[model samples]
Target chain A: MTDATATRPSIAGEQRIDGSDLLGDVEFLVARVRAIGSGHAREALAPFGLRVRAYAVLSLACGSVSPTQRDIADFLQLDPSQVVAVIDSLEASGFVRRAQHPRDRRVNIVEATEQGLATYAEAREAVSRARDRSLGSLSAEERETLTSLLLKVAF
Target chain B: MTDATATRPSIAGEQRIDGSDLLGDVEFLVARVRAIGSGHAREALAPFGLRVRAYAVLSLACGSVSPTQRDIADFLQLDPSQVVAVIDSLEASGFVRRAQHPRDRRVNIVEATEQGLATYAEAREAVSRARDRSLGSLSAEERETLTSLLLKVAF
Candidate 1:
């Protein structure tokens, strides 16, 4: 079945009949690209038994510092309950564990296990490949520019 | 309560300890900024009884072309069922209506009601202001660059 081609803008300026109005909107563009990228990452990480969110948690855990659940929630912009759930799943898979903070006994820090690091190494490669494929249209310079611009808004 | 400072990078060059590793990852940055921007839009759009996704739908509906349900789904990268649900809500709220396509009887096009267009105009202003607030850190030129880069990836 033929889909609606009415929405596609023509170069000749022949009375545009489409949702091209949304094309210039930053939020819409961001959400669209993110959804597409996330879908690709999810598919790529599926063989590793990891979703994008879980992979994000694992990636953060592989960082230099052992992040607490609260830190994960804040950095990932996830709810505390959601962070707890991802951590719980990661712990069950032996990817991460909650331990008492080195300086603060009252708090728990999430640290990656050896297996977790190894798994992350593989998953990171897969995720990177997936990202590269998703952003294959852009040049290296464009990608770098995109990243730098995103950081200004993101952080 | 003192949150875990472990994840915060030290400024003294004493070995940066944080998820700085994921900072360069485009997908992560996109997700982060999108989350922050969406949150701001959500709050600003609340008074109009719209969320980001719904606002997107309404914005599309307000465009020059009356988009079909399939068109909306394809353009938004949303599930057809989800589009149907959103359309149902908007239709019930008198914001939009499903009409038989002038060119194709079998196709139903989604068009904004007068109320929908009026509401959309106000919501667009709110959403734009919210986006400006969320992206306050960037210069106007940077915002344009960000939007252009996002469009390249999104389209």
Candidate 2:
């Protein structure tokens, strides 16, 4: 007997249909991509003892500007409470240091330590490489189109 | 004195430029979108006392056939430890119940309670509307393009 699951008949006088059309839904596809990327990053960062969020916080704090907690949270689109934990972890690891703001006592100015910056630099490269591998299948032009479309949606 | 900050060009231009150059970087964009969506969902689900992860877990449990803890984690790309806390909270809130799997003694089959399903149904609609409002600025065709491009990147 023919494998019913493996064989599907095409419409009369029409081109054959692969499962691609049925398999393709933009949202679902993106969701799967994201899931895969997140998993990869989590594993990649684990050895360095950094969560993705902590690495991002460090990346944003690498510049000379001593960003406030609110600034970091806003840029990262994270809650103030959530930011506290990420900061705490970094601070505990001595990767980041929090200072009292001169003008605003309520605001905590955060900066990446030398250790933090070094770790961030390496982690960023690793992340970039991992991403490159994930998008390796797509052409450069297709990649550009995908990024532009995401920005268009986000902005 | 001229405001020192006044001459500091806005990051909006930088954002656009980065968007153009970094279009093919799907992993980077995925992280940003997840951060943004998590923040937005957090605000909307606040009244219902649900974090985005929690809501997703409950929703999956409600809809899935024989969803185990591993299944939810795999679907959401969340860490097993994180999934445990999320499930623990849902179980505590009486929104979900965990049972030993009939076939696999090692697995716990998670299912949403009536209250959980009801809550999820309402939140799902609200979340959809919130996403619509968030993307309202885009043209219908743009949204389609955005979704399609994201799928291509993801798949």
Candidate 3:
């Protein structure tokens, strides 16, 4: 294993494995950043009894579009079944509710409960703090640039 | 749910729910990109009988550092138990071997076997192709810029 105190520039949470050449791989970098971000996010949401994936669902539920289970699954790149499970748990927690779709009765739109919005508001602040701390290395301008760049790659 | 053909600009895989405002979150963007990347990676490595996590381990083993299991777990942000299980599978497939660590008797250094290196060479090419398709949105220079920014955030 490479020494943490070694001369080489290291990765954030994981030590740099020079041989992996993953250092240069875009996919690898994306994964690494997500892993680090999730760790911070999980900690921030812990007191709220939320996982990052659930937080994502909660975030969407609070949105105005009133996404359906299929919408959440496709957007999050998660399986449809997983989305249902998360929605079930959120519904049980009184964070969200399923209502009949306006245009399509067959569809059940996922909406955030009043309590869900309140929890999300607090959790959002916590997430922002943790994200800022992890991304502290970036200047605001650089983060904006990074965000713009990531938007292109992610979308 | 918002219609897929809605007037609003949409995310690549997930529809944009304007209120989630997660559209502006850096961590969310990072997660989306990685999720997309992993899907492509899993498809590419399927032919080699390797999962993305296994490929990551193999990538490290083939590297010159001669990483220990702890090294892999730390770098990948996976549990130590998960790393051990992956190594066990890789070892069974004759892709890697756990040899005595030169400096620490208790530590086992993971090294790629000749067969493992051969499998990795082919798999790496497949992974590169998949990565290119997922990141096809960015120009070569843009990918480089993205990588640099991710390095700052990741490390």
**Candidate with the greatest DockQ versus the true structure:** 1
True contacts kept of each: 0.60, 0.23, 0.65
Interface RMSD of 2: 8.8
Q: Write the per-residue lDDT of candidate 1 for residues B68-154, one digit (tens) a residue.
A: 777788888888999989999899889999987654576677889999999998988888899888899899998898888888888
Ten-residue stretch with the least lDDT total in model 1 chain A: A8-17
What lDDT does the true structure give each of the candidates? Answer: 0.83, 0.67, 0.85
The residue-by-residue lDDT of candidate 3 on B1-155, one tens digit each, is 45645643333333455636788899999988888899999999999999999999999999877788877887888899999999999999999999886545777778899999999999999999999999999998888888998899887
| Ranking, lDDT, top scorer first | 3, 1, 2
- Screening candidate 3 with a backbone cut-off below 3 angstroms (N, C-alpha, C), the clashing residue pairs are A12-B155, A75-B14
Put down candidate 2 lDDT per residue, A28-137, tens digits, no spaces.
34556777787677777887898777877776667546566776776666789999999999999988999876655776778788998898778877777777777776
Q: Candidate 1 overall Cα lDDT vs. reference?
A: 0.83
Q: Higher DockQ: candidate 2 or 3? A: 3
Pitting candidate 1 against candidate 2, the one with the higher DockQ is: 1
Taking all chains together, the TM-score of candidate 3 against the true structure is: 0.87
Pairs with backbone N, CA or C atoms under 3 Å apart (clashes), candidate 2? A143-B24
Prediction 3 global C-alpha lDDT: 0.85
For candidate 1, the docking band is acceptable
Docking class of 2: incorrect
TM-score of each predicted structure versus truth:
0.89, 0.60, 0.87
lDDT of 1 by residue, A35-140 (tens): 9899999999999899899999999888887777767888898999999899999999999999876555666678899999999999998989999988988999
- Model 3 residue runs over 4 Å out of place are A1-19, B1-16
Total clashing pairs in model 1: 0
